[model samples]
Target: MTANPLDDPFYYLNNFQRVLAWLSQRYADVLSSEEQRFIEDFSALPRGSQGLLVRMVMRKGLRFRHGKLNYGEIGDIGSAVAPLLALGWVDEQAPLGLVELFEVLLKAEILSCLGHLIEQPKARKTEWLQALEGHFSQPQTFRDWCPQLEDRLYSLTVMPLCDRLRLLFFGNLYQDWSEFVLADLGIFTYETVEFSAESRGLRSRQDVDACLFLHDCQQRFEAGEALEEVVAQVNGLTLDNPWLERRRGKLLFQIGQHGERIGDFALALCIYRDCTYPGARLRMIRVLERIGEYALALELGETAAQAPQNAAEAQALFRIVPRLRRKLGGPPVPRSLAREVERLDLHLPRIDPTLSVEYHVQAHLHDDAAPVHYVENSLINSLFGLLCWPAIFAPLPGAFFHPFQRGPVDLLNEDFHERRAELFAACFAELDDGRYRQTILRRYAEKWGVQSPFVFWGALSGELLEQALDCLPPEHLRHWFLRLLLDIKANRAGMPDLIQFWPQRKAYRMIEVKGPGDRLQDNQLRWLEFCHEHQMPVAVCYVQWAEQGA
Candidate 1:
């Protein structure tokens, strides 16, 4: 692959054109009247003009200095920018505020432009901004801001229009024009999944507007805007898309958490009461407890205890319910016994400060017959990813939206496993009859560096892969994979840190290590309990530093 693929001066332009063409083809109905007109008008421009426009759009901000806009392929910048100005897309005289003007100006230019205002010529540009903050509250065109400077500043007027087109193309604002350059340079290799008509992230123009509105609300919330109005607006915006609904829920959850941080229990309680995000109920209970609403906390906690959302909520409720009962002057709730996990205690001399606890444990336990690898969450996840590649990458409707996805759009959605039930069933069935080994081995060879949501290729070496295949039981893999399907968001993590494989005996034991002052986290505890219930070999190893114990 070429170094940049920007080797072709038309690379950025080509990527932009591809996005526009994609929108023209796939998102015709979703495009607004303005967006549609812009697309049509953009197609009619000269190649150089198109290239220049794209270069400007793809850059950081709306404003670009004419001298900085030079591209050898686009020829003269003035000629390229002329057609854009005629269409009012590029405005040479757009009103720029002091802050916006300061962004494009350098230290020397700032000195030249506003030398009289600066008390110190050698002061930093940031300091100069503070020194001249209130002096130029009014906005002005670039020429007026810097009368002595000869360069023209081009401000893109249709940035919002271009942003909508971009949002339509990539399904989100985070993935930008660089995706094309990345793909061209071979930095990323996405699986080629076939798309269906039902695969659009934003299905209709209304959906597009809703998505943009929700995104704006998120920006406002992050910017410390008034809570009530932003929260009300977010709640008011009705969404038909499940994906968009999830985004809304997540944003609301963030607001609720932010409210808690600011000591606004009332606001936090208000947000969490109706918020359907995963951990909102748990947060509501915590807030109730925080504000001395013990009865309310216990009531909700008891309800949640009856049917917890997931293991995470269940674990939290266990601790919360007991405390709430104790606080409410009720009879003491009997605590359930924690399952007995195999324990290993270490007090080895600190030979190296840089090494991790897992590393120390692995080094301490290594032998010719038994070898330990610090697999953590990677090994099992990678194995599952390799064996079930076909099932995971199945091109179902709404699973894949574009060519750039590492995994399905709905990978964490509740129906993710349900939709691919049959596909996953077939993948799991291979494990029962000894065919999975070859399937996994073959996939390991073929899909070595292909992007996968599960596979940690950097962590998984060939030797470890072979060792796992030989030693690990097929039945164990099935249990793990099935549990992963149950609630992928919750179950995928919390795996044991180290795995000691007895290659000779075809045996393995997973170890969860904890350094001094460390204890088992909820997820780690859940994994340990799950392993114990299933009769899988797992242990919790504790390390106490420089103690009297020998």
Candidate 2:
């Protein structure tokens, strides 16, 4: 086997020591032997592995490590790589490698390659930028745009060996400029969206658990078992419960959701008023919106907004405010969310420049090399429209990260999780009331639809209800009642809507829904009898599906 360049202690140590000296001059503490070793090992990987390592390091940035690199490491790496890439030591063809080298270079404040790149012609520099812009603007699926993208980049007429090499890091963002793109030139890409979905401990486990729950629930529901019983079964299964801290709130919200599903507004309202966690507090606002309690939901949302500027709080407010207006059967929005999503839109300055995406094309200067082309602009706009932009509009919690890209390589490590959690909290707080709801609750509802998360919500109703009810004033809830009464009078949720409720007969029937089957469950019958015995009228009602696809 060929010896690795990094295996030589002198080579890595000498290089690593110099970088450490550079870092020490700026930092208060001296570099530890462990950190130095990690830097050396990271820099010594082969070209392909180096790319991954560099991104991993940069994502972790400036931190000491006991095990794998953590947030501090990611921060340190970012500080180093951003400048290094802009300075041009880390070429596009080897982003990972370049990131490592750049970190060292930036720490040293030594432009070893900058002197070399400066010798390139001015025309070549301009051409490189144009090619990069072209590639970025085009929107074929990420992998499909490689050929055209790489061709424009790699074929640019830059002179001097160093300038050519620097092109690598500059184009890292382009789909065609990736190491994966190069690997695909002669090899077929495995078809699947999950191509890059590697297991990272808790997240992967949660995904597995959720899938299992869904499978079990489907089986039970299909077997004519009650949905509540199935919910109980899934709720009892305890695998990895990272969400335990917020469990009470989450469960209360879920119970309220169950009430909503069964058309038990009173029960739903009671559950919404009993939960006490942040997650549950958010959910109550959503439930209120769903049951035509828009004004009340809005007030609850406003209360959440006052507590913090977190993404969840902001998103809840954002979505609830607009949705309430719509549910109150108001006129069309003057501007859709997409136009107003600038609420939480973050802008991270381009701190440095590196390789342009054409490195994939440039790599083909070797015998097996093939030309890489980036997808053109119109298509890129479409792809962003379909993928990136929609996420912005729906703005889920922790969705809008601080645009540093490349992270979570050590997800199992507690430090990384804490850092991620903290960052998520900070980002969540950035949204105002309206945007917070839009990002957290409304987006979650749309993404999960009227299902899944709702079931999750059902398990935690008590905590959620208490928090929301406590936060909102009784007068607001009373006003909401009056408005809902008006809506019911105007024929909402099918009329004759909810005239009264009575305990004598064990039920309250406001509207009787009749369909093709025209059947009622025992619960419904009990409710009807109770209402009738107490002198409340049970009105048979008919309604139409807005559309037929279900």
Candidate 3:
């Protein structure tokens, strides 16, 4: 197949107006004249959206075997144009009516690139990093390629860090920066230690080898080398990038540790206070406590404890409060009160360390199948369920484990696949009118080893449970598992110490699923009671099908 001239991606984007005119004609029969017109007048869109749109078109061309775009290929084509609309590239009154088509193009490009990032990290790393360097480099080259980008793109955007980390770490530009760019790339600075005759030139490879030199300095420092000599040789560049500010706290904590090693307690405290990361803030508090600065530690630890996931740190801070009292000879801790004085080594047990909320959710979804022996093997049922989905249906945010079946956005309104599956299951069950209805219910309860007798369940209760199970189809079970897996993701799930629910009850739940032999602990019982007292029905179950282990 002859290449689509549109596929030729190049800089000098505005310079291609004449070429666009001819190519629009060449592919005129393939695309409607309206789309051709959009292509011709592409420069009218906002700069960002225009870049997004052409990139979209270039991707669309790749899916075509012989220069023919199918409905599936073009369904999201409008999204590409959307960036332009979003950026105010084109006015609402503009002549171009194919904005929707442009969106589809954008979606295609996004999906294709994301798919590559997920499936082929090593293969895509060089290109991905190069693209990033090119976008974000001065004059707009690749996108931002810093450690902070990890926090934004993967952590905040909810992209898979596991899949993209290799690319971010080992990309060509990353190697260039980490291995050769050094201080120029903005990571570290260095001093000339024993200036070698071999290292003479300005652009010598050694000048770029900042990381290696930093490692050597650290080794020398550890060996108790003269600090004055090393300090004199090291010129201070001290990175000022705003992005570096994010890691400044970590660096401060490290500096504090170094100060402590050198018996500079005041300097250590100063470095610790300069840290903004909460973990470092808590560490500072701990350091103060260790040094008999109880009052200062209490003040700092109290402040750090207000943030989420700081309970562990708070416990650490609280333990020191009494010790400080004793150190000052204020009063002896009472025998009963002594128990409340937490041991420094025996920290508050992390709530459910082995099983995370996501794992808890997946196990709940598996219901009867969660294993008793270990956390990892407990996911057998959910794993099987996940394995059932089409490979292409690999876990996607918000779509995994959802009750509804997926289709193109265009077909979603009319698709009844989920409803059809539920209705089909109903067809196989004994109806309420049948004499066997009670018998079936009884048998089901007994088979699952339920202690309660099967009764005439309320319509609402039956319907809710039916709908929940029906949502999990055998064909797309993997997607469901993917949803659960995502829900447990460290970044996505956060800490599940407490389950929060919205008024509408979307994106959160408080259901408790149990196996036949399982029993609620005291804390679990109290939680259930608390939830019940609040009038929210926390779903609880002893599923039978998961009997032998999911």
Candidate 4:
């Protein structure tokens, strides 16, 4: 007897084919006649040619150069291009003009540095290109202009969004839903340093392909497509790549999610077992509980609670498992179970004194007229922002220059720590000479006066700025600099809340205020620890509700 289709290894690919068929039918209204015909033609093409067409459509430029096609899975670049060329989807010898050059540069994020040149009135495209070519020809000029040109060229946006969506969703069938869901699940893996250069390119390409397939399957399942219909399409479909094996768990997790969405709790639970995906176990227990399988749920929950990978997972399982056991009319949790679960509550609300002590202390001092202060996270961080101005707003050489990116792309680089001493030395030199103050004021007046990605900039008031400058310590500033360099994403949040200024003493205190039932999170603890180590004048003020007569 043949193995069940559900147990087949190529089940995923089969499901993908069904989804493609479904998309072709569902998107008939929105897709152009040519697009529909293209889809039909695409289905008829050999799998290799089909994959090549997907890549060509997804590739960066309107025209594909013969030489560039030598890389990646596309065999005999000419053969691949022939079909696409015949279809008129890809042009081999497109003319490059001034407007096209500007658009290409803009997409490449190189336009910002040369924006002034391009924005010149009455400058033709030919003139601009000629000027740009001249600049490129002079080695000294190119070096002085952009040291990172090579890196920038590698990072240019290849496919336009509309084109990507047309290929990805096959014309509005699923739209951006696949990208959203995949991103949410952490499937895209934007951090590229982990993979080899060649693997990085391959993985990125596969990510697009996988997202298209997953999106189709998800849409089909949600649209009430039958399981048999999906399984039948999978009968002979296969993907022979290491990427498929690597993504098997994620694919299974997605299948489980689809199952759950369609109210197939048992199917979801079974798929979750095969998923090996992070958070799958937790999801399985939830599914089991939902389906009235109390005994199995309790058993899995008890086991998971004891050996969870992290404190958060342990805490989550501990919180829910006990409740599950109780609902099942089971005996009270054993002593050993209780002991293991007890550590999970170490950082719980009852033990945290932040809320009670911090908020009340700050509240009582509000009546004192001598020391003027405001509860703000913006003030000090904004001062740090002034120090970061050159690196933050400086038009980077080849960085993906979007209007939204208000900081250096390299700010998140792992090697940024190596440049910390040099960067901060310059910042401190400006601070000591009072140049930073001028720059800060100038920046505030010019660019930052409107809006910025840094939350502190928008909330910075003149009074607060004055207080920050007066109270700022070189050591505390250095600590913040180090913290920001260490990890910009992690360090920016959880700063001290209330900053109180003593104008007479030329001093200020960084106060972390917590209301009743509030606690310091991990990031806040890290900041507080840094302050303590640096001997910075930082305090935690916890509020007592009863003392305040609330």
Q: Clashes per prediction?
A: 0, 100, 34, 12
Q: For residues 134-219, write the lDDT of model 4, one tens digit per residue.
A: 54442222223444444211112223433433443432233332432343344431211121123111123444454456545556
Q: What global local distance difference test value does model 1 have?
A: 0.90
Tens digits of lDDT, candidate 2, 442-481: 4334432121101232222332223322332333323222
2 against 4, candidate with superior TM-score: 4
Residue-level lDDT for 365 in candidate 3: 44
Best by lDDT: 1
lDDT (Cα atoms) of all candidates against the true structure: 0.90, 0.35, 0.35, 0.54
Off by over 4 Å in 1: 1-7, 133-137, 546-550
- Model 4 CA lDDT for position 476: 67
Expressed as tens digits, the lDDT of each residue in 1-550 for candidate 1 is 4366678889888788788888888889888889889989999999999999988888888889988877889999999999999999999889988788889999999989999989999988888999898898789999999989999999998888888888887788888878887788778888888877877899998889999999899999989899989999999998888889999999999999999999988999999999988899999999999999999999999999999988889989999999999998989988989878899998876667799888988899998789999999999999999999998999887777778889988898878888998999999999999999999988988988889999999998989999999999999999999988888888999999999999989999999999988988888888998998889999889986654344
- After TM-score superposition, what is the CA distance of residue 521 in candidate 3 from its true location, in Å? 20
Least accurate 10 contiguous residues by lDDT in model 4: 339-348
For lDDT, candidate 1 versus 4, the one ahead is 1
Instruction: List ranges where model 3 is wrong by over 4 Å.
Output: 1-242, 258-264, 302-309, 330-370, 376-550
State the lDDT at 527 in candidate 3.
Answer: 38
Highest TM-score against the true fold, candidate: 1
Residues 1-550 of candidate 3: C-alpha lDDT, one tens digit per residue: 8553334343323323433543343323333344445564565655544554433332422111112222332244345445544544322222211222122223334334343433434444444444444333232101221212211110011012211221212211122112212333333322212222221111222322332344355567568775544433332424332222333343445556777777777766765665554456666666787788877765665565565333334445456555666776669665323112111121122235575433444433442222111122122222222222222132322122111122111111112224233432342232223323333334334422211111112211332322323332322323323223322212112111222233232223344545335554434443344444444334444433322322
Superposed Cα deviation of residue 95, candidate 3 (Å) = 70
